[model samples]
Target: MAITDEFLPVPVPESLSATYLVPTARGSGAKPAEAVAALGERLSDPVGDLALQMIDSPLMTVDTRPVSQFPELPPDLLAAFGATPGQLEQLRTANELVVVQAGYRPGWPPVHEWSARAVAAAIAQSLDGDLIDVFSLQFLDPATALRSLPDNDGRLRLVDWILVPYSPTDTGLWFTTKGLRRFGLLELQAQEVPAQFTRAWGAIMTGAARRLLRIWTESLTEQDVPAFVQLPIETTVTGHDIAVAYGSPERHDSAGSAGLRLDLDPATDPDADSFLTLLPPAGQAAAPAEYFAQICTRLFGSGQPEIRYTRPSDAMARAVETARRSLRSARDRFLIGGLPPGVQLVVKYGLATDEGQEFVWASVTSWSNPGRIVATSTSDAASDPTVRVGTPVVVETADVVDWALLDGRGVIEGGWTQAVLDERL
Candidate 1:
């Protein structure tokens, strides 16, 4: 289905932004102006100079905000990002941050972000500095940042920009589209979502944020923008297309809602812009639980009501075996490189069920070995309604149906069964 938009009264994102933490020594680092000056020459069109000079925005600027004394790097960030000693030392001794911003190029795939990324990476490479995605909170060395794709492969980066943290203490799962604000939209939030659905919610909400960014970027006519706006976000549903209306989370006129409580925090909120949920369309007759379950089924291949392809062809079965055979290499890659930003590794498991064996995709957390991998399920049960989402699972090498390493944008390796299933299924 085509992506449609409704007009809204909101501030437009003035520019796309990023920060390069420059070391005090500046060791061979090209000056900020020199970096940006050369960035256009370094990149080709699509992700080129357009980042700095789009319509209705100011020219790309590289200004250094100085710090008198560098602070110690946070222990958690260093550990989580697996920062090397050199990187940690550089960050601790960093004296200034170079903030690069380009005019907003609001359109499909957000390619201009690559321009900002390339510019930052070039400067960091020249300066021997580090990169921090201010909006996404992802850390990139000059090498990784320099590997920007000129196409939709970059959309994978958006998944990080959304901070979807679910907490048991609060009985809430929260989402903050901290980066979408880069496009002039209010940072969004969703609270009170059940733990079982958090996994699905992560994908769903990020899709919402990207959808909003796309719509906001495309709909730029002169109007005060409506107090409330409605959008019909789309996604694939079991090979069919389906969508439900979403809007600013203003209070509902009625008490009953099968959808989420959509709250639109004004820019003047004395605090920050992290409030984030969705309600289905204004008036849909179906019950909330059943309605959304159908969507979950489509997106995740498992939900309350589901359709299962129980048998694999002989060729597909052989492909499945092929995936199992190659796990050692993928395991080795994980052991060496670790799962860095923009990389997702999922392993499909074949768990014995009363009906038969259920194949489920689990987000791999660690690779102790091909046989001792730990992961969390990405969906509810496929054929079995009793299975739950967000289940902690220990994936044994014997039962693995496939292993896929999705690395930043459109690159992926392994998943032999998946490669053939797309054609043979």
Candidate 2:
């Protein structure tokens, strides 16, 4: 399959692998046969293609000669990877470094990822060693990395193989994926986007992978990706809510992987928030955020209550100043965001209380010299429960926090809060 304008394709990866540096395992005299046997026994079902590949070849290897060998990483680089001094010492000097790898062929991703990671992690645990997520820059104990096999219904935890982090570079801010290449799919990214939009990218990028695979599995034609992906007003699939372009790595440090860059063209993505764009035509809406949250809970939960919220960071506060500066321009382009045939305009009024200040979105009903007469709110997100959507409340903009104007097709201008709220997420 090829990446077309309408549909993004999942190209077969040139290489798919999970690599781990296990110290003191092979040097301590652990055998490859033992690891393989243990993995097979642990699997509930009979060996499939992945198991066949493993059984037919070597899964764990260490240098047989006298010369010592191990993975090499600079001290500062390791520290940047969140590695502790203890981890650094072990990796640098360990003479018996066993490289546990699970390699797969082109046709499969879910099974391959599950099987390969499961095998590598299971072996590491058996040998009492550690594993690292090279892209996420994370070191892991074997038990923490281990995953349960597919259940009776054959459902796989698809989210495990993809991660989107808010990656910033000296040149620019970016949102990029660390794991899509594992499935032979292009890693996803969005450039120069607001920091808050990073959370939305998580759902969109992962959703794209699932969408592309479904297209292939069903043999469908190229369906156009949305120009703007919205947190759907409903769980309905409207193809205009989001978009991304197929491309190559722009940054020198990206590991040179294939990429699917989200179309955060200033007018559309700034306020889209991508509420719900992962559904099929007439399909029940599933917010990728909500779905992935459930998936993580089911697979990783320890039966303990999760601490789900955190206070906004310092960076988020800075965005407020940036938004405030842009308010004059937003007012200047009151109807159209300059990128418009002027579809809609909503101004945000900041409500301050003893606890904190909150920004509310309201449709502009009238205009004054320095204020806007906003109509019944398009949203019911106000602190006052009585101010529901369509509740006729003539709001006086005493304090204008920020605002976003939409063009005819839903392109947005000036929604700084989206990026701000993402910090909390």
Tell me, by lDDT, which candidate is best.
1
lDDT digits (tens) for residues 1-425 of candidate 2 = 33445443232334356655555524545454466566654544533335445645664232222215434546675565467777666666556655555655433434445555555565566766665565455566655555434533443444554555554322112455656555444444544332222343454455455554443334422243222212111221111112211111131222212223223222255643221122222232433322322322232222111111224667655665677788767656653434233234566665554556555555554454556464534444435675533334465655765566543233256666655665555
Give candidate 2's error at residue 164 in angstroms: 1.2
lDDT of 1 at 103: 46
Tally clashes: model 2: 13
TM-score of each: 0.51, 0.46
- lDDT of candidates 1 onward, in order: 0.52, 0.45
Largest TM-score belongs to which candidate? Answer: 1
For residues 337-380, could you state the per-residue lDDT of candidate 1 as single tens digits? 65454465667777776777777776566666656877655556
